[model samples]
Target: MHWIKTLKYYLKSLGPGFIIASVVLGPGSITVSSRIGSEHGYAFLWVILLAAISMVIYTSMGSRFGVSNKDSILQSIAGNYGRWFSAVIGIAAFLAASSFQFGNNLGVGIAMEGITGVDERVWPLIFTPLAIVLLFWAKNLYKLLEKLMMVLVMVMIVAFFFNLVLTKPDVGEIAKGFVPSSFSFDSLDIIAALVGTTFVLHGALYQSYLAQKRGWKVGDIKKGLSDSYTGISLLALISVLIIITSASALYPNGITVNSAADMALQLEALFGSYAKVIFSIGLCSAAFSSLMVNAVMGGGLLADGLGLGSTMDEKMPKIFTTIALLMGMLIAVFFRGNIIYTLILAQASSILAVPLIAIGMFLILNNKKVMGKLKNNLWQNVLAVFGFLLISIMVYFMYGKIITYIQSLS
Candidate 1:
């Protein structure tokens, strides 16, 4: 009976946390992790570990908004802040997220070329259409995309371990990266990149809606917590492996790459030409996982903003999915170079938005009319406040840099 109950819980927890974890596997993460390894080797591994732990805690806060309120974050925003504000957020989020689709599409194409020994230019034409078809066939339903993400997870984990075997890293140096060291501005840009890579915006925002759609009530807090922990743990595991493999082989040779293809080349330098094949396999899975999750998120945001409920008729789902697929394809075709710049800018924008969302959710959850007995406890409020302030400061730093850059351009 106990085993049966556990199995049931796993099935129940599937769609929400899994999708969130899937988005975390995007090009932002793969490139940044690879860069970390190539530059400082194992010295930067602690950043990934810290970000993974922070993600688990923050993801819980966002997910609880749905479990307790029975509303998606966007829905709640629309109800309290009015449609204008929601529209502003929706537009901003869509544009930012669309840029990511382009980045991932490009990343996937590059990864394929490395493995197949083909020209990079040919891959974008092949992958964009295929991804559109895959997404179109799914109808953008969260449950279906969630399942696809799970399959990608299996493929990626297998590829990760295989790459680790090819690298055969020194465990001692890997251990040393965990010790907290003093900050240096030379590495600050890298640190910022890692932070942005780990804290994905669409994943966090979509999680609340996913939980509500899955019928997770405030009573299921313990179950939701378990699911979040599991999701973040998987992310941490992959992050560690990427860093380990790259640092062990690429760093000593001073080979730094800005994309997944570059990382694949570095891997080949270490293990052999076959190493590129293994990297390509893992990269494809990572990009696919992110693409699937983000497509669903974009559709859900549009539908919910238009006042659609959790249960839509068959036609509505198809419409939303088609719109999302088209948008993703358009972005992919137009997205050119500047992968690092795009990621950094998107993350900085998200950090600016998080504080407002956090504070609003806290107020709503505490409202007696809304949550009643489901109001936040002292600890929950404490966590939310801390997240709010932490993001606010990060945003300030990031925004300052943007302003400086603009001023210089002028």
Candidate 2:
């Protein structure tokens, strides 16, 4: 009974971190991690650890800000910098979410097509409306989202772990994957995508807003930190499991996964039809979970940017959320064949917003006026600097890749 009470208390404190984890573990992460595992085996596994550490640091900062203040991070920016700075951050966050929606919709379509044999394009049309309904009509939006994301996280963990067990991966290779190694051009691209997807700026910013929605206060700082750690650690674990599964199952066979369907086929070949179904379910959960959260982030932030209400219940935000979803679905439908490139491009584009958001949050968090005793300590400041440099490196590589892609197109 005592343990049960403790469990209930723990569960009550967890919300924002899981939301960030769910959004980060979306279709983009699945597809990229699977592709990396299939192509490079465990060679780049170190990247996941690096990305997870960065996630914990930045997300903790966001959570601290949320608990330290009564206002949203956007409002804090407005107070410290200027309204224009806040607006820019909000708008940029919205655009980044919109870009990510493309991958989210494509992932949903692929998972549906893989499962039901319907046209992939049709699935997006069906799922988008369902997402809209959940966003606008749910009785308690925050509770619903929290429960839903927790379930999805569980589904991903079990499904991927089952597949990993079946793969019977080499223990020695798995151990070596944790060791840092040199990278090739292609590996560098995958690394950038991994960083972009895992340590998401919008997801980081949304953490503060989410904590506020969950009614956390300065007294709850320790709980918030625990939630952030639990969420990102789960994220890193699931990611590594996917890579291990793919490495054991696909890498050994020289099977390159260009789409979720390709991953399904390979899983079928390695672990029978049941594995394929499980992987598809996990993929759909990932895609759908991300679809809803990304829309919320994009719409909510856009609403805030335009001086509309920032909360999820606001009509303007809901409207913009729908627009973000529809725009992503349209892109996914028209450009189905290029989804691999589309996912990569979308993840890369997120680099544009990372430094801006990170720097703003850093400044705001360090401001004694805003944060009081919670103002970043020396170690937190050091980590923030490291996070900034990490974002800069990702941006540099992403820029080079995008330019190369454009030149190839021309």
Q: Which candidate ranks first by lDDT, i.e. highest?
A: 2
Worst 10 residues of 2 by lDDT: 181-190
* TM-score, per-candidate, Cα-based: 0.85, 0.96
Tell me each candidate's RMSD, in Å, in order.
Answer: 3.4, 1.5
Q: What are the lDDT scores of the predictions, listed in order?
A: 0.68, 0.85
Error of 2 at 33 (Å): 0.4
- Tell me the lDDT of model 2 at 96: 81
Q: Which structure among the candidates has the greatest TM-score?
A: 2
| CA lDDT for candidate 1 | 0.68
In model 1, which regions exceed 4 Å deviation?
1-12, 134-140, 306-353, 400-410
Candidate 2 lDDT, 1-410, residue by residue in tens:
99999999998788778888888888888888888889889988898888888889889988998887888888878877898888888888888888788889888988888788898889888999899889889988888999999999889889889889999999999999989874676566777887876888778888888888878899999999999999999889988998888888899789998866788889998778998899999999889999998899888987876677788877898898889988988888787357687686777667776688888888998899999998899998988788788888888878877778768777
